[model samples]
Target: MDKNTTDTPTEYYDVLIIGAGISGIAAAHHLQEQCPDKSFAILEAKESFGGTWLTHKYPGVRSDSDLHTFGYRFKPWTGAPIATGDEILAYMKSVIDDDGLQPHIRYQHTVESASWSSEENLWTITARRSDTGQSLRFKTHFLWMCQGYYQHAEGYTPQWQSMSSFKGQIIHPQTWPEDLETAGKKIVVIGSGATAATLIPALAGKCAHVTMLQRSPTWFTTGRNANAMAEELRLLDIDESWVHEITRRKVLRDQALFVQRTKEEPEKVKSDLLAVLREHLGNDFDIDTHFTPRYRPWQQRVAFIPEGDLFKAVREGLASVVTDEIDSFTTHGIQLKSGKHLDADIIVTATGFNLSVLGDISFTIDGEPLNFGDTITYRGMMFTGLPNMVWVFGYFRASWTLRSDMVGDFVCKLLKHMDANNARKVTTELRPEDEGMTLGPWIHPEDFNPGYLARGMHLLPKQGNKREWQHTHDYWLDKDDFPAIDLNDPIFSYAR
Candidate 1:
């Protein structure tokens, strides 16, 4: 079916995936393997396939999580666990090529609004060509929101006092310019998250001197890129696929224990993490002032630095860290409350991102505007009152694609079950047992509270007290919980 930028109606499919990222790709694979009869197409907003990987062109941009778990379960990751953006994109392209999913993907097709018609029992989508400025329409039986959570157009940069006073160019890592000169420049990178950690190392030797300016410290874990278990297995002449599966399970088990340790013994966990930090910067560096984090481990994401590159850059004098409040921005540099000033020719704001609710798409159900915040979630994937729709919002603590794979299985299974029952409309409903259940924020701040999530909490859907109603960030629990979901459960409302 050809996508018409004109007013002509396009061919309808059994399923329509919203993005061509990892989640969308995984969904396509599952639909082909599990729901063979289901016809589907992927609508991508970007000019290419990779979502975050394609958008983020910052130097040293790489996977925050290892590729063994981050990569699709069906695909064998033969490269290093922590892969580069190019490597990950190549891996995705391989999936697209090998699976023959290219023709189904329409790039630069940005979906602007979606409406679900009960009378017609179908979804009418309004999208625009990012390259053409022309509107198009797509109709499908089911809508899969795999567009991801954060706004990719711009990263969230805080408005510091007197920011306009600074004479140097200010850049965000999310939209890093290709032509921006870095050689022999004195740069100051604000924010101590993963982006800052990655950019500081890549910009180290290139810049005259780079300084990482953070109001507070963030947790970082150091590790080598290679997986020793997978290496030993491969040495025994085992198949690469088997090695990938075995290595992925072991890594996930280790991550689960690490998450448990962070909660059960936060101080011990903090001590172990600090010990790793000390190994990089030595015992004499001001670890307490500049490296020590105020919050408990895992409250925010702990960035993994390959061989402690950021700290190595700091120790070797290529980069420096400043732990002080920004009093104001001066003409040449930032003014610190401690009466210290640092010179910078360029400022990189590595501040996180803004969370986007359902890709910022205006949705309507039965001709009435749908407010996602007014609805409750079903295991963070499906929502109440939204029939025949599933949103692939992935896990925060674990590799994002882990849940994407899980949802792929769940969606395919549910579609088959609906087929068996001959149902056209299916939506989630609060069970009688859940009548008095407490509804909370999308994610508990205690479990995870990154700056973006904190700022966008109210804009997200509500989570109930039960397992069936919340977005459980725990992948270990969900691996079992999702497969055990009964198709005939009272929480599911199905209609012909």
Candidate 2:
């Protein structure tokens, strides 16, 4: 309860964490073990605890991947696999409560800037309270940034030309207006990712008609969101560790098998996946237009629904899919490039998120501006020139939490190594030969918008391994090698 410790330069905390989301929470949980006396404060932009989980509450917002590997490894989920937003939020809140982490959290404090001071060996953080707009400054020796991309919790909704002229009310699923009534209205959902897929089905049941508008195709799959195997294990008299291992391996195997099979032969995999989707949709579903995806299976995040509920909604005549280029917005509805018009009373734009690096917050080391564009990503956790800073960004190819957990473990180990050595700061430095490496498109460079893409391939690490760069996006490899990674190696040195 050290609120408003802003009269003078606040007491120097050994560690400072930005964003109280899962990643930040995990960081604090482990950081305490390494340096128990080191004070740490988690500065959150919002008023509440759950970062993305509480922020995004769109109609069918849930995890596309399984929950077993999507959360902290230290804490296992006792419920279903693909958890809903509410469930995930509750889990996050429980972690805060169970660990007594509320005292470390300072809510409504939005970080505006953080600059490293070489002379003082500390970081000066400036933040303003969201409610009062009062600015405060805090200092920390080590900083961990965990805030995610996306400016607002209420997802992104683009301005369609002449959208205002439309006769109906428009709704972006991200900021779903609680007061706006949607009962018996004709709804048109834009985009084909998880949000669109989830929303189409959830809205179809209540709406008079629903139309899913997609510019390009995306890989879609059907599975039971809930983990049946876990439930069965719970009913039986089995060891808890055995249950965890069984569920973990099962989920991992299922996801790995699907990815491997799809990668072995993309065309056949695409055809078969589409075929399954078509069958789920029945004769009424449009296979030629809706079921086909333009990209390969893993190019983008696939859409998953519990037991083909979206397809069921389509077959039940509650919703339909339209795969066409959007021309523009009409007075009463949308005009498609196919010269077709669809009337809608409510329009939900689920186009996707605007991905930003380091929560799009700019950083500086000493007096020089740290150009993220020129910096090379080291281990997907730290940048080359960034000293005393560690980042937690997940791999798009695998489970997000897998990399997060690994990074978390590695960071804790790194912290312990630093504490034992009495080192104040540690940074990743790349040799000149390691420059000019190209990173894969999994991180999506073009996704940057509204002044967020400060770094490109120059910033991201290379796809393949070359000693200093460990781009092992694989979970199993990380579990095996991450803890054993040489923290005391001369290449990565520490300064007192």
Candidate 3:
């Protein structure tokens, strides 16, 4: 019953989930519902639950994606569409409390490495305790990696020239210090990604002034926080779960149509986005200069500016935007490539994340080091040559949890099938039909090219051109396709 202590003999579990984040919680819940007989443990590196929500502590921190879709399918998100970090933590807590998942989660256990034994048909996991610096070991029949994609320890801060010359404090949104003073201070936030979009408005009124400096403009979508459909369903006094499912489907349909338009009628999509920005900033503001992006809509993540709050800050003169490259950092602030300088008391690098490959945990197969890049992904969940494991790599265009929920069902079903067949191992590899299949980067850059993924693509597994070989990321198609997946397909290699 006790978790590993004092480097005790390796504990064993039917499953070891590598995080307590949204995906991890969903995975655990599925296991509870579908495979109750299986012994499992959730290893979380943080002191508590809520992975992304717990790690990020900046002001106005919230979900860029709406909660109805982001929240688990089994749960009901009755609050506003865009929820704050605290609200998200509350939602996650309710799920854990309702499911009684606390006893299974071991916090502060940072998984350092994993090694697979082909003969034993198990994975040996090594973890270091943040609290006691104690090394722990565990053996598991399956590994569910829900640790999330980005490096949580530190946010990615680009090395601008002469960074040492800056006199003021430099902060990254990922590790926002609670004690750092922001009242009446002049601030410059670099990058126009979601983090920057979320931070500027939150810091605007409190600070003397805030300026968003970006190398180039990024596309954005602004709307009210409320979901009218959800409100309407609640008025009808329907069950909360039914209301949630109804609203979720409506939103997803809208998202699919929106994504379709972005590809088919990009110009119209661009015009509408710019029109919304104009309505917020007005004709006097140089919208074309500061708000226009080089890429089409959804090429990168489109930050949701609830009610145009960031734009309101700009209109009120509390914040401003400077679209220029950084030449260097000066004693006072940043030197722009346009021969201008931005002076600030504090600089926040809202510069996005450094993608972590497999939680940055070193892996070996039978005493030999493994390179993920060597293997191609099998539907973006399982990889070739990796057995009895599934990583929750969610959708970029849709809510992340949707894929996680789907993958959860897949893994649970897989476990039960293994049990029924009296099988010990399952690994996927390309079939003879895939011999001439062309392999490529994890994600085709042209379809979506966010900065974080672009930087870390090399560390990820490859993808084949075939449907089964890629993380489709198309929830609409995958919704049906996933359930119909043949377990006895030639691609799957099972051993007893």
Clashes of each: 0, 0, 0
Clashes of 2: 0
TM-score of 3: 0.98
lDDT of 3 by residue, 1-496 (tens): 3333564789999999999999999999999988999999999999999999999999999998989999999999989999999999999999999999999999999999999999999999999889888889999999999999999999899999999999999999999999989888899999898889999999989999999999889999999999998888888898998999999999999999999999999999999999988888888899888989889998888889999999999999999999989999999999999999999999999999999989999999889998998999999999999989899999999999999999989998889888889889999989998997999999999999998999989999999998899998789989998999999898888999
CA error at residue 376 for candidate 1, angstroms? 0.8
For model 1, how does the per-residue alpha-carbon lDDT over 112-173 read when each residue is reduced to its tens digit? 99999999899999989888777888899999899999988999888989999999899999
Off by over 4 Å in 1: 1-5
Q: What is the lDDT of candidate 1?
A: 0.92
The pairs that clash in candidate 2 are: none
Q: How far is candidate 1 from the true structure (C-alpha RMSD, Å)?
A: 1.8
In order, the Cα lDDT scores of the candidates are 0.92, 0.74, 0.93
TM-scores for candidates 1 onward, in order: 0.98, 0.91, 0.98
